[model samples]
Target: MLLGRDNMKFSNKIVVAVIVGLMSFSGVVVAEDINTEAIGNAIGNITSEIETAKEIQSEPLDKVRINWETIPGAVSYRLVIQNGESTSKDAEVKHFNRIPNNGYELDTANMFKAKDYYWRVCPLDYDGNVMGPYSAPKPLIGEEVNPKAPLATTEFEKMAYSPLYPVFSWIPVDGSGGYEIRVSRENKFSPGRYEVVREMTTKNNVYYEEGGYTWPGHYMWQVRSQNKVGEPNTEWSEPKYFDVEQHVRVAALGDSITHGGGVCNVPPGYAMYSWEYYSQVPIKNLGCSGDSVQVMAQRFDRDVMPFSPGMLIIMGGVNNFRAGEDGWDTIAAMEQILAECQYHNVIPVFVTATPINPGLMSKVPTIEPAAWNWKEQQQLLNQWIKNQPYHVDVTPALTDANGNLKAELTTDGLHPDHLGKKIIGETISNYLLTTFPSYNLTEK
Candidate 1:
């Protein structure tokens, strides 16, 4: 009996020892897990703090200034800017990378041109590996205007016409009691040829009609402010230039792409409507961004007919395709627009629809991917355009072997860059050169 009890006691002792060992092992594992979790949380907090955005101050054409809290260990900050939403670091503007200063001024002392620019700043360690996260990119917009002049907003730089009645307007200047507008046949503001047709009050900024001008005449106009409480005449706004022609002017009509949206590479500024870039003919830009075929048809009379275009260069249908409208509807709109131009003795020049990059388009949150049927619709529309007598196939010049746009030619998936614009201009210019020899042509 004694022996049996001793055996039982020894067995109990062994069982307790085994249970204690297992508990100790679990305790060690729990401690290790707690330590790992704490470390991960600490790292996450540090990253978040590092990524905080800095305050940004920007003035038009003056400077792009940034201020941020100094990081404890950061030796410097790297700054990068690209043409609006370009996504590629390769597009970063020159002399703008990893600048030693926390504050940066772009373009030396010269003004930044009008453009949509994206900028970011990130801290760097001594080794230059990017420390923490980059500031969420912020967008900056620059506008094109003479800061000192009585700014003329529209119809200042392009070909102007009457019957539609070209309107001359300027923003009201402060302390100016009245304004004087002088129009001249020549650029030199000689007294004999210069006519002061109207003196306007501070209340009015527009010239309804400056009479006595012949058609097809080049004209220069200037405005001078009469200050209410200062010197009699301030410096004249840089002479704004325009041309009045009786004959039908050539006009390029399409959507925003034609309107010169997103077509910038050189300086930071708004893209001139592509027509403005085309020197081959006196082509006015009638392209409104984001317009579908139907919308364009509605505005044809208001925008195109008034200019009395000798030839209306048309490129559209992408917006319609993306909008999920019937392909036939787009064709019908084009047919109607063309017919109107024909009725008025305006020749119709149809350029095939530029290809869209759905892969690239899908990545842009603002742009919706085309439906599966979008390509088919585009193909049909393009084929139909090719069948036309005056069709200019810009597709071949702008597209790649895989049917994507030549990457260099476009800033976004849809809009042409400088190279793309050059390609389009060359194709159209060549077409017009061969097809219409009688028209006056200029190449730049």
Candidate 2:
């Protein structure tokens, strides 16, 4: 009996040992698996989150774009942006504050001319435990150019300018041809709902259309460019206003200088300066960079005549400096532009050519000589112009003694800066206001 009892005890001891061994093995496997409680602890460890947004873009005076990285398993995203003062985190521009995102406008000098941004994603499980805002998103950049409202390039053809239907025809914006025009008389116009007057196949030409009215007397117009993506870019042209019959129409015509080669900083072309922006009269720029008198003469009928402008401001003969056509030849072309205007009842104002840096004068590979020098032939032309009925000389007022372009006026040895534009425009404006008492062609 004692032996039977001993055997039973031995068997019980073996069974107990086997059970403990199994339990130890099960404990290791359980440690490798994730549990709900473990995930909760991980979520509690996070100290920061998207507040203002990971990436942002703002137009200097108008709009803002906000984007963010996604949460690991986020079903949706909450992108909040705030304006005011930042306190701690990227939350400065967050919606967390009472300041609404829509309340602020971008300060041009403070932020980037064009802003680019990026973000990542967060994955969320069925349970709200956020795994991660996991991946780096592609980078995006804000467009740097904020095209100011476009001005009309032409005058009221009928001469009866109306607040109700101010007729305007402007030089068509390239790539923007065949586009939809958005007119905002008083309020900001919807760019998307604009009427499609132009189409995909349109090219360079004048665009004349009846724009919609926003207020009783207020009116504004803009044309947007289109492509395969549909409405592509909306850098607005200068905005035009129609008030009274007293409005003036002026067209600045010539080679590249009128086109703004030096001032613009774009594609080696000129920049638009205050001349067109500040002049009270409607200014039409008929300047094409690197054009010759021959080319100018060819396009003259189309460029100078149609505006029915009160005045024609011509600033060239520089590109004609070394042009195969020199002296009387160059003068003859200038005369042609003037005679056409005079015949059309348009006033002709002559601008002495702006000085050229050595580099630009050397543009033609085969030629090299003077920079900014208008030869005796050119001088004869200028003298002859002064003698004409409609021709007026507007250079001595702006140029230094010796006829050299004022050094202070240029940005690069060639292009004029804001200061230069001021000088040039003031000279021209004063001339118009003084000489041609009826001159009323620019923005006032």
Candidate 1 lDDT (Cα, 0 to 1): 0.61
The regions of model 2 sitting more than 4 angstroms off are: 1-248, 261-274, 322-324, 359-378, 391-394, 397-403, 438-444
Each model's Cα RMSD: 24.6, 18.8
Model 1: which residue pairs collide? 113-268, 114-269, 114-270, 216-245, 256-289
Q: Rate the local accuracy (lDDT) of all candidates.
A: 0.61, 0.46
Q: Candidate 2 versus the native: TM-score? A: 0.45
lDDT of 1 at 92: 69
Task: Give the per-residue lDDT digits (tens) of candidate 2, residues 1-444.
Answer: 455878866765565455446655778434234443444444344322332243332224333323232221132332233232232346323222211111112223443422443322234332334445433333223322333322234333312233122223433332343454555434326533333222322232233233212133344455545554555555555554443222237766766555542322222111234344334444655566567766777766655555456777777776666442456787788778777777878777777655444443344343355534454545655676566654445456445565545655543434555556655656666666777665443443
